[model samples]
Target: MAETTNDTATLDCLIAGGGYVGLSVAVAVKHAAPHMNVLVVDAAPEDALSTDERASAIAAAASRMLGQLGLWEDMLKEAQPINEMIVTDSRTTDPVRPVFLTFGDVNEESNEPFAHMVPNKVLVGALRGKAKEVGVTILHGETVDDFITSDPTSEITLGSGKKLRTRLLIAADGVRSSLRDKAGIRTVHWDYDQMGLVTTVSHERPHHGRAEEHFLPGGPFATLPLPDKDGKHRSSLVWTEPTANAKRLMEAGDFTFELELESRFGHKLGEISVAGPRKAFPLGLTLARDFIRHRFALVGDAAHGIHPIAGQGLNLGFKDAAALAQTIVEADRLGLDIGMETVLERYQLWRRFDTVQMGLVTDMLNRLFSNDITPLRMVRSFGLGLVDRMPGIKKMFIDQAAGRAGTNPALLNGEAI
Candidate 1:
């Protein structure tokens, strides 16, 4: 319970943004250190999560973390395991798109699929429920208007005029985070000038849990398998295109849109029709110069935002949650200040390199594939084919994709902190 003094409540940690990363951090810390009081505040209304129709690719290690957090059993019912994945590079008008790479084997150690397609609503709902069970207090439709960090405590003023003091303040408030701006943290940012048009489609034939990524001149179009809904075969799509083209497509009529969609989606899954409302998100890369400061820290997209070319943005956010939670829990066990810069530095060092590497990799991939250069396409296709033929290399790639090939934190390894 938070200690109350006058009109202010004091907590061990106060997190901005009640999304998955923020909720996960609250649950992890409070679950491991039950004596601490954790709170999450989000600007969005409580009902916002229920209306999200998008989906994310949760890596194997992330699933393990979720299981250890005691939230996976219910989520597993709706999750769709990605049993296989194929990559192809072709034009939108190509008669046939030849596969350049294929992945089908499960993780060698865990025998788990590399990843799973989970609906955003299901994931957020599970996290919210678990956070509540772990005794993490949440404030909906509220924002942290401003905050002042002074050594042992950070005093925050909420949008509702409520005041709170916390030992640590964490920002998980999306890419354009106001809290981060208040902290005066600089970011290395760039816009891709592309928009990812996301929607769900019902198909005549089942996908059989196979994920596909087609790299065309505009960008990569990914069709990720989803569990059948009411006997309807379904898949979630992340169709990338230039900003102008994306706007045009989004404004197009249903018949016209489906015709264009079919040209790229092909008939492999039989006829496809939109089953959900379409949304477009602009693509960009934003990496914070620093992940932490005295009594403050950043997590999830608040720290870094990368292209979805590799489908690892959410997974990377999960990695931050695990690492930051582990760092805080361990520091508290030693009777040290969890918000101190010395302790937070451990997390920044642990995550910075990996985050920057992924950002650069995704940028390079987007630039390389989102074009029509003849020589470049041939080179990339050959590279993909070469990687596909090498079993050892392929296994390494799969392990990386599964989030098992690294110096992972305890939570990511499914171990309790």
Candidate 2:
């Protein structure tokens, strides 16, 4: 099925879903509306190979929204830059073993590297080669099984029967968003009997860019740092368990699942070896109660999915495509109606309080570490050893996990319009 129709021109936006939050909200809405036109669509299954088999954790506010969409300098040479994040509690044997969080200097005033673990097809191939060098068309096997709109545009059709007329409609379609249930929107979602499995590993010692997280009572495993094609070190796990123990560790026996993922990433990589191929996903907490209606608008996971424990699911969809591309580039430079509802209610009032406070802090960190609770495991492990002996609250929790604390929306502070 290959469909491409472009005759009745006069479109300005249409993006449905080309993955990675619909090709980074169609190149952040054509880099803040570069003469409109943006298209983007994706149904996949046409020998699909624009890559991405899952591996997302960008964060430093999506690496400053990929350095303000310039595509983070060629995805930082196959990315690895975590620059620190530790977090272990390694499931109760408790003899004072609690370092519940660490996050050291990611980017605190130019000493960069707060996050970057690329490979969502190399950051969607550097945002589809910068949306085809600023043109941003991208069709990809077509989709959108139905649609209709007017009062400034939108008219689609195509489950492979080409047809579309648009003015605006952006549903970075995903997490069960068939154009948000064909624009009738309604979602509350649930299902976190846990799953996140992910893969990649091969260590002889070296994950020095650092990122760990252990927790385990059957959830929150983490293990990041990656870059090694026989370069002597690597990692990229994620692990979160309990879904019948991640389906019995992906049906075991790859040497008993690399000796149980080298026993929880062999305590900071003295071992580990399964370099790829192992997946699983199904940890939820959807939320689309209503992102926006009329001319459509609902970015990433089609408006919320939360809980990668704190990899902030695609940095909350690049802070919802950098606050809906800075509220439709300052309401289309004053002409407003960038898909109205007063410009998508300023991206639902700038992302409904950081998506309900990061979904109630990753659902209270997955119900306080998936329980083995002995008084909330001793009050969050003595409140993480009292914020690790308070070094100004551990540098404000490593500057809010290096996304550099809230109220940031200039492409998450990498800046550019």
Best by TM-score: 1
Worst 10 residues of 2 by lDDT: 1-10
Candidate 1 local accuracy as lDDT? Answer: 0.92
What TM-score does model 1 achieve against the real structure? 0.98
My TM-score estimates for the predictions, one after another, are 0.98, 0.34
Instruction: Name the regions of candidate 1 deviating beyond 4 angstroms.
Output: 2-6
Q: Put down candidate 1 lDDT per residue, 1-417, tens digits, no spaces.
A: 632222467888999999989998999898899999898997888899778887889998899899999988789999999999999999988898999999886555577899999999999998988888888888888889999999678889988777889999999999999999999999999999999999999999999999999999999999999999988999999999999999999999999999989999999989899999999999999999999999999999999999999989989999999999999999999999999999999999999999999999999999999999999999999999999999989888888888888899998899999
Model 2 ranges off by over 4 Å: 1-9, 12-19, 24-117, 133-150, 154-166, 171-213, 216-221, 229-232, 236-268, 271-286, 310-365, 368-372, 375-417
Let me know the TM-score candidate 2 reaches against the reference structure. 0.34
Q: Clash totals for all models, in order?
A: 0, 0
